[model samples]
Target chain A: MKRIILSGYIFLFISFVISAQGFKVKAGGNQTFYFEDKGGRNQATFFSTTPLEDINGTANGIGGSVTFDVANFAKSLKGTITIQVASMNSGIELRNRHLQSPNWLDAAKYPEISFQIKSVTELKQIADNRLGFKILGDFTLHGVTKEVTADADVTYLDESEQTQKRAPGDLLGVRAKFSINLSEYGVDNAVIGNKVSEKIEVGVNLVGSNKK
Target chain B: MNRNQKKILTAVVIIIAISFIVWIIFGGEIFTKTQVLVEKKDELFPDMITKEWRNKFIWGLDLTGMVSFLSVIIGGFFYFRLRDKKHK
Candidate 1:
């Protein structure tokens, strides 16, 4: 009876240790995650509020890869997140066409909007496996490149049966938000401030896997 | 009303009716949207994906332009009617 109770205690202790393991224990030092999902579940969204109208738009052509050093997250993190201009959709077909036309984003000329991550700062550990930080990056839009900072939250999930259902390897979930001024990006639309606000808020939510 | 006057009136009424119908069909939005953003929950993750645009009926170029186009057409007709009456 004493041996049985001791075995039970050993099992409980092992379970507690396993469950308490953090991102550092699961992800180790350096891990690179590719921000490509098979279901095209990655998303980038923009919102513009003006006196005349409020506009909401989304683009799903998100593709990129981030190499995150779990040990040196603030300095060694780097990646680029991209959105295809043609994938931008506003609710109206005519409006979408107009947006992609030369007067607006001109998808034909500049095909992509990208943010290249330079560094992470102000890192805050939100949970055992989650982090919040400010990311400084170069935001390129409408053929113009500008340095921008975005607030981001990242969560690391170790490979498990639950996570395997979504992808093959360990997963990193990133949610970042920032705002941009259209004029600064050379997007000189006449409807700015009327139909569309000059500054638009952008959000990105993506899940990346460390698998190939 | 005279025949020309009657014709212009009928044209105006038709244009108004068409405009009202289009407005009702398009959710009666005061200003048309250029694009729509769609968000859906991921099945496994605590995140959202921008799904394909739905609510197709709520989209189009600014209906204000359509109303203006119809007004210009009616204006041309009214101008011709006035010219004809003057000649007579």
Candidate 2:
């Protein structure tokens, strides 16, 4: 039993070390922005319709593969990004709370928004330590999934200049922008057709590290 | 199978009937008005209302579901009350 336990510990440690070569991601708070036009959305609950302010929300609860090096993060990586809906904040206290309510996105039932990369295309080296590409994936929101393509620009930082001292390897900075149609994801509404833009613009930035 | 079982089942049906009648008179109107309000509101704040809104109105499936829920609670309440009276 003692020998078996020792062997188990060794196996776990070895696997951890091996997997360290792959990048782990820490999405910074306010780094992921989900923007919506707020002008027309207020008339649903209020009678007087002075256009409300634009709705800008941030969710820090983002995760999934940050793995990759210049040769790997995009080319060799099959990454998934998951965002917890309950963690989203729209700046307005009541609106922020309501965004997760059953009346809106029903975060209690559909608690997550996720994207899974199916393919990466148009990879080109823009300059030294910089690459530009497009990523196609299935973006699932409010229990609906739709294929989307995001334009991505990756900038490679020096291997030794690591901000997250807890992790090993080089840092790859990624900025990806994409557009999603709310109606396409079963999130249609009267205002969405008119006041709010049918398409929601999303932006994400993260520093990925290739741990070795 | 026994007297208690039969009595409880009948009480449950009665409670369900009462709930449906009440829904028709009061909850029914509230549900309808809410539906209209939601639609009107959607005209301005279309993105504010959710997809769940449509099916929860008076003539919708969720209204029927609410009736079922009300039936169970009314049934349980009457059963327990009758049992307590008998004991007393």
Task: Tell me the DockQ of each model, to 2 decimals.
Answer: 0.46, 0.01
> Compared with the true structure, what per-residue lDDT tens digits does model 1 show for residues B1-88?
4677667767776776777777777776766654334557765556445455655445333575677587768766785666545435
**lDDT for every model?**
0.79, 0.56
What tens-digit string does per-residue lDDT give for candidate 2 at B1-88? 4467568778667766776676665545322223222222122112222211222334423465677687678766666555645434
How much lDDT does candidate 1 score? 0.79
Interface RMSD after interface superposition, model 2: 16.0
Candidate 1 per-residue lDDT over residues A46-104, each given as its tens digit: 88886756777788788989986775677779889899889887676777899998889
Model 1 clashing residue pairs (backbone)? A90-B35, A90-B36, A91-B35, A91-B36
The TM-score of predicted model 2 comes to: 0.49
TM-score of chain A of each: 0.86, 0.67
RMSD of 1: 7.5
Model 2: which docking level applies? incorrect
What is the lDDT, from 0 to 100, of the residue A140 in candidate 2? 94
Report lDDT (Cα) of residue B55, candidate 1. 56
Error of 2 at B87 (Å): 71
Tens-digit per-residue lDDT, A1-212, candidate 2: 99999999999988754443322333321122121212212110111111333444555565565444433444564667777787665444565576677656789899988888887777666655666789899999889999999987766545453334523444555567788777788775442335555557776655545543
Residue pairs with backbone overlap in model 2: A20-A211, A21-A211, A23-A67, A44-B41, A68-A73, A190-B46, A191-B46
